[model samples]
Target: MELVFKTEDAISKLLTIKIEYFDSLQIYLLNDLWVHEMEGDFFLKEVESFKPILKRQLKYGLNPEEYINKVCKRIKEKLEFLEEHKVGSIEFLQFYCKQIKPITEITTFPSLGTDFYDEFKTSLKECKTDETDLYKFLVRFAEGNFNYTKYHEFSIGCLSYVIWNYYCALTELYRFVSTLQENAPFVDFSNLDIEDNKKCTEHLKTDIKVHFNQDKISVAHLFLFLLKEKHIVFDCKDERNNELQLKRFIEAHLTYLNINGDRVPIRSFNREFSEARASTKVQKHKQFINKFIYGLEQYRDSLKD
Candidate 1:
């Protein structure tokens, strides 16, 4: 009984399980409207409670009313509007489905095709440390060549953003890593016990009081090490490598190659992102969308990509 206070409440963890339900609902709502033909109480039963619980779950920081307005009210109004204008026919159903298309409808980033993502993952799987200058710097830094310290802060900052949207990725990855129990056959954790073993691993900054072991794939360095094997330049260069630049480069070579035209928000191409003359109006629109998709990329690039 004494060890009980040291643990998170069982009900909190149970509530955490509800996050998957809310996450799927949010993703479904992203490209779809509440234009479904269903029982009248669907909103009350399926969605109304989700807002309150999810808001609490996320510890929502801004626009406290956003979930209520965009999700709860948006669906409520849509259902009412649709009910008043309800029409029944083959074309109407098709149109309804079309209007509420899922992002998965494309099956992949449009220009990138379905296989590019798979290929990219394969590339990542094949990556190794010897291929990266940063890895070499890390190695020598470990070996007592202190010059690596000169680039320490700069490198960590660059590495942080290299995997674009990693903060969100970590949320998803946490689900996987948390399920990894002690002494898993594949998990070679010599130093996994360092610190609390429950906090984020830092690459630098001694004050953080947490770090990852070599076997920690969750560490950004190992991920970057894998990325390096494919010659994908994610190293945060002094002023040359921005997220958009790397994104465009990857899209061009991996996604848009042999496709004969750039695409939008999902798939795009440009061997070089900064070359201002090489884009169409759609490309320009997508540039805006991509900037919006990961605005941090643009802001950071502006600062010193």
Candidate 2:
């Protein structure tokens, strides 16, 4: 007797596993969000949850062939379900993968594709040891209390977008490193304990923390790393911007109400948020809030100097 698996079925299965992987990441983020609210330890809370799952997955012993087969099967099922619904699972997956569209459908920054390589080269050329340069901030970010594993999840979330929206060319990632090497000594990322790093390998987790926080890093440096390695752009703003904008608007509105003696009794802030969210022109309202708050902040800052 002979055993054989159909390739299409294999792909579907893999995608299903990938979807599950994404779901696990979502759960992690949700937990982190809860922790953030409670001012709790994010990494410790996650490890408390992760160890049990890891034990269960490892119970059957190392079976790469079986594991791979199972993953492929799951992915295929998901794709089929999407196909039946007349939605490109690929397209839907792309949107979901990027943290942006899932949160709000406001803007679509075109995936950099190969142009990212050019931007990276240009950025690296302009890199200097500036304390405030965005690239420096990124390096500092890498070295800071970023929780690389969570950062990895964030990266994966971004990658889902990259795979779904941009060209699914994996080679572009490796090529990015070659480009970086052209300049100077870049981080030896191979030492990093990313998803596939073997057990007992010397991981870069501690070192990443130590170096990144020591000095302000360059945004250009960070951009190159993300673009080449992670396929994400830091300044390709989306969800974070939206949130900031909404926050600004609400603060400004409160200030105005206080000044005008409008007699609008301060009610539940949550209720107001709900109402604003329910509005048809939510984006416009959000923008209005953002602008007012930003302008007010700027005006205040200006007064000092």
Candidate 3:
């Protein structure tokens, strides 16, 4: 008898397992940081806890170079450990899964699809039965066949999907730490002249309000358009890229408004500027485009006078 399996069901189950594993791992790592007040998302909490330390070091005239190197070294050590024990072992997986809280929904399984499923299934069948308990468990769970020794032989197969999820989480954590290090010097705790800063802030706000502020055009979209039009350029030599600098400026202004009794969620920016610019090229925004062009022409006519 030929055996058939619903790949979607298997994939969905695996995806759920992966998500649960990652969620548990995040909580574990966060707890390791000894953070008491968990206010926001994982990344935000990480930044909140980490930023102050860097600031404090700089304020005290301590060399942050040694501290950053130590942190990176620790992260690298963890990465190496994770790499070595990612697969061919089920102890870590079992430990993490024990802390897994039930999730209400599983919406995203990035980079996992039909191709991944095919490769996973083929690898499972090829793995040796005595290689590890993980392989034995997977085979039994997937096929529901206890007589696997009589039915088939297994060899060491593809890296377990669960390990892939853990590796990705760790890798992102490393990148976030690296970014914080790179942007450390940009964090200013001293008082500086506010006149120029105020002008730049107001200019950005007015441009957004006048030209690009629409229900359909997000701040991210506007910034993206400006970037493409060469209205803004990222200076490679700067500690923070132009995008980060702009984001901080806009967010600071929003915070000031909020403090003055304006209720607003922080604006989010992303790389969807191309879509916004493309939308303007269509007939839907033709009138808006024409108005902008006419304004420019009027400015030129006034200059002629």
lDDT digits (tens) for residues 105-148 of candidate 3 = 33443232335335445665676334343444446333342322
Ordered by lDDT, highest first, the candidates read 3, 2, 1
Candidate 2 residues 89-136, lDDT tens each?
234444545433222221323322234334433554566344322233
Q: What is the C-alpha RMSD of each candidate to the true structure, in Å?
A: 25.1, 22.3, 19.5
Q: How well is each residue in 121-168 modelled by candidate 1, as lDDT tens digits? A: 344356533534333323422323222223332232222212112222
Q: Which candidate do you rate higher for lDDT, 1 or 2? A: 2
TM-score-wise, the better of 1 and 2 is: 2
The TM-score of predicted model 2 comes to: 0.20
**Candidate 2 Cα RMSD (Å):** 22.3
Clash count for candidate 1 is 0
Q: lDDT per model, in order?
A: 0.29, 0.31, 0.38
Per-candidate count of clashing residue pairs (backbone under 3 Å):
0, 23, 5
Better of 2 and 3 by lDDT: 3
